[model samples]
Target chain A: MGAWRHFPIFMITVPLLGAVLLPFLGYVREKWVPYASLLPLGTSALLGVLLIGRIPSGGYLSYHMGGWEPPFGIEIRLDYVGLFLMLVVCGITTLALVYSRRYIEKEVSGGRRTAYYVLYLLMSGAMLGFVATGDIFNLFVFMEILALSSYALVAITGNRNAVRAAFKYILMGAPSSIMVLLAIGFLYSVTGTLNMVDLAGRIAESGFTEVLIVSYILLVVGFGVKAALFPLHMWLPDAHSIAPSPISALLSGLLVEVCAFALVRITLSVFTMRASDLVMGTADAVGVAAAAAVLYGGIMAILQKDLKMMIAYSTVSHIGYIFLGLTAFTAEGLTGAMYHMLDHGLAKACLFLCAGNFIYLKGYRRIEDLKGAWGQMPWTCFAFALASLSVIGIPPTAGFISKWYLILGNVEGGKWLYAAVLLAGSILAAVYCLRVIYYMFFQAGKEGAWEEYWHDAPPAMLLPVWVLSLATLFFGVFSFLIIPSLLKAAAYLL
Target chain B: MKKVAALLFISALAVLLLYVVASMPPMGDPDNPTATHVIPRYLERAEEETHTVNVVTGVILNYRGYDTMGEVTVIFCALAAVLAVLGRERRGVIHGFVDRSEVPASVIVKTMVRFMVPFIILFSVYTILHGETSPGGGFQGGAVIGGSMIIFTTIFGLYESSRRIPLKVRAPLEGAAVMGFFLVGSLGLVGGGNFLTYAWPRVAQGLHPSLVVWLTVLVEVGIGLGGAMVLTSILFAMIREEEEIAPAS
Candidate 1:
């Protein structure tokens, strides 16, 4: 009740303060900037871990801003779901910052390094705010913070393609923002308050109105563009691929997942009391789009020659899995979706970091160019292989656990076809991932090039990649650590 | 073909939106749900509770202060983004105008800008300070300050304006302004109020009864300062050409 309640707010402000300080720190001593940037994230991650321990015992914590109760002041709500996602976001950010220490210096110019850290911190802090806030309008504001920072990060590379991709991303992104704002305006008209809990109750009493339906559609489409749902995913691949590797890892690993989390929060919690028929129809639409994404992304990934692009496309497919699980609307499915989000976040980040290491060390981006990469950097190749196994849903890897739950949810929902699609998607994933693995380990090197570049990555970069790879295996084997929280969260939502 | 398809897609979306708009409750209906619930409490008690007469100001700066903090951060971040995209290194000279030394502004225009800038800044400060009781607030006031700075830059040139507020000083000030906002918000926590909570007992202790109003004013000042610094930084980033790159690019 005392300072303990302040942790959620600190989780956001701490990073913000650090980000604002970074430019000056970089000016003072460039060496200190990277390490200084970690202070806020590490603190926030520790806070997240502490909150996780306290939340299960204490129930959800809702701290009102400015000491005014809800429906009057802004609230920071920490439920099992929010805390768990915060842990994921903060944990990944901490690791990415560590990995970026050496990577940013090499990829970004000296003049731009401080701005890179500043934007990185801003993006992560904004994402934390996005997940932790309870007010709907507050969520939109945080969303814009993250979105703007991400666009700039995407273009930070300043290559022709990077700039073009960032521009395209902005064009697509602007409408999504407008749609979300318009939806908020509609909801506000119907209900005077902007609190999520209050809106849910009022929406139920108001029944299924056309305004509500319109808002719901707008929310989905708005968030869908951000989440990179199949039809609206054009901006993701180029933006993800062309970014500096660490930024790529963060974008592919966490940004889209956060959007999906927003989608789940809106559909399940805020619209829980909507007309059953409308819910079913919306679920069907989401399910079909997810199914299409799984197949389409897998096929596109197989066709991709660039390693980063392939991984980015595979993200589209993995996002499909998360959506597929959520739209199933069962407790098992919801839990699966949440678990998959964590699993994919870890595995994809590992993959992107590994890809980045290759690009950094040898400047090789093509899959065929990576022939005999294992001979050069065996540890990195091994990590990539491990992460790919998880990507393909191989057993005893984290991906298998989520896929298992999703398939079970599909079966429980009597959607056998979705179950088949899930299986087929895994096989397709296997095809794309195996191609990279095969070239990395088995394919012949380009004469003596392997031996010339045959050195392990720096400890700073290798450490985070290995930690993430190990986490993928650890979570796959010991799903018990996280599944209970996931179940509790799923139960709360459904 | 692409244009036709785009046209078709947009029209379909527009028609759908129009349909939804038609079904919405009549515009500004007093008996509407928005008017019935939640707002009355705000309208009636906002002044007594938060000690601010302007309900919108009270709601934004006190009741929903967290959102405003996020908004300030967003603007600060946008500036950071602009700096990131455009190199932080100052350009050797401003682009889009003849060298100011070679082509000085006409006496009439220079005198006019010299006459106008101080008043513009003065008015902006007035608006920011009186925001708790008036319609004007940090965002508008900060924009006005930025506009005046722009005027200074345009009339006197980047070199002269930057010399007045050097990049070295401006960069840290921009960051410090946002840091101030974070520090102020954190005061609520220190006082055992929730984050950004202005009316906590501890915060109000030894202060006036209208402490919330004062705190609201303080936050608005922080926001105004931060907004002005961010706008100035963004302008600096945009106008300055990279020293290494040729203007013809």
Candidate 2:
């Protein structure tokens, strides 16, 4: 019981220490690299669950770095929102690490495998810190760690397109980082303290409305690009689709979502004042653009040639849903967004892992090539079908529960048009998500190539896929357990 | 039309940025929140609390050392990024990005570099050791050391550089920065203090001042070495490819 006291720092540091150890360990034994990478994330995930269990009823866990008070020292606070984000980060990353074992052998060159795992561990560790930290500048540092690792991971395949995509990522990503830095600068100037709770108390008192509003816009735009919100989403599909699949899973499933979580954290906690109508309009504008992204993503997803690319586009749509709920400014919307972050993370990660299996088993990249894929790899296709239903928000999966809350949230906020967009968007999701499921099970075109590779993915890869895919179903029926907690956390956002 | 749209957007952004700038508190104002609220505590008690002559170092290495730990990880990540993309350097290979001109540096140029390398290294060590008491710290010293590596490579070729700083030597040190944090922070934990706590009350009933000094020294050395190695490797990886890439045809 007392062990949970230092769990927050341990959760972040363990994986970082693993990343530091991986290269040297690679020299000792090549096979040890995969399991070595898994251990830290596995431990981080365990720590995360235990830490969440220890959360005092309605109270948060705070660790002040250097034993300094909140105003002076760096603090790591795991409130309900951060606890939820931490669970998603640690849990999904552990699964991704499990899947990366066999999949990375072919996708990454042998020499770079250690480097790839190192970046993956660093990215996950930074995300754990990013969510759990209570300080703003510390958040920026974690952002860079995560972002730099993501850029490296994207280009890890070392092909021309992968490198090009990663460059585009850095181009957009790096400038956005500077924008984030400027925003942090603006914030530090306005309020001397870098701590989030301290800033929340000081912001309203400072009353420098215009400067605060500008900084808020800067943070939003900066994180908006990272989250891949529309008009800012050009870098996502290529980067997500080109990387090896587990990396794709981590990028689509968690990285963009964490950026959005950072945005939500700053919005709800740091800047609670009604600085201006401009602020409201800005939120509304983000919501509107998210609506556009939903539709844009859905329509484009239907037309994609590549399987993972389609899932990447679907991620854009799901991101739209989260931001839609987020900007609606209703407790229902916020809860829905938080829930969607989990459900979407699980579903999308499952979808990509299944896609990776297809590529692993049959070298299936395009939708057309997946025709009769079920004949060869029944389990992956089955997992795909189950998760895609969630993506379409069917009645019995966790995605439906979150999507329902999203719709309910919009309606509660009187944002009827966005609510309708939510409905239409899912219908579009049905078309795109089901199209692949339909191809694998129904279509039998060009039978020889599809049937040539006639074995399912090995269980190492298949089990994680099934676990994620099934959780969507299990959570869908049982979401009531966590929904109240999510709603409570959302209410505290004010 | 695309260019026009981009220009228009950039202009709008500039205007917005200007508006924010116009609203900011005037720079160096005595009553600015940064001066009145943020600086005084750090400037006033930092030397006594962290025991470093340079207040900035005391603040960076002791109070907010976690951020610097993250920064070193970022540096390490950048190196990983380059290695992952271009691949690591092997002893006997050359890359297209490497200078391929047959003519080597003149004897005097090589001699001068060979002579200056020692001085450069000595100065860097001096900078790193005296970092807590002065303006230069791990990053500055590390940059100088890294510059020496690049210069040595530029004149003496990649092979000589590799021989001097072999993969075995460099591989382990690349993560020294993060490892340094883990070790130092755990020292705090050993005393029942929080992570990254260099010096705190009642830890070990009375933690020694020298222990805190040792923590900063190790962290500074770790960062200095980690940064220098990452930069050196990234440069080497650029010029040297593991499997010769067919010499770019």
Report the poorest 10 consecutive residues by lDDT, candidate 2 chain B. B94-103
What is each predicted model's overall lDDT from 0 to 1?
0.85, 0.87
**How much is B96 displaced in model 2, in angstroms?**
18
Backbone clash total for model 1 is 1
Error of 2 at B177 (Å): 1.0
List, residue by residue over A1-494, the lDDT tens digit for candidate 1.
55567788888888988888787677678788999999999999888777766777226888887787888778787788788888899989999999998988888877678889999999999999999888899999999989999999999877789899999999999899999999999888877778899888888888888888889899999999999998999999999999988888889989999999998888776888634787778889989999999999999999999999999999999899999998887878988888898889999999999999998888889989999889889999999999999999998999999999999988888889999999999999999999999998888888976775559899999999999999999999999888877777787778
lDDT, candidate 2, at A332: 90
- Regions of candidate 2 where Cα sits further than 4 Å from its true position: A274-278, A452-454, B91-103, B200-207, B241-249
Question: TM-score per candidate, in order?
Answer: 0.96, 0.96
* Model 1 lDDT at residue A350: 95
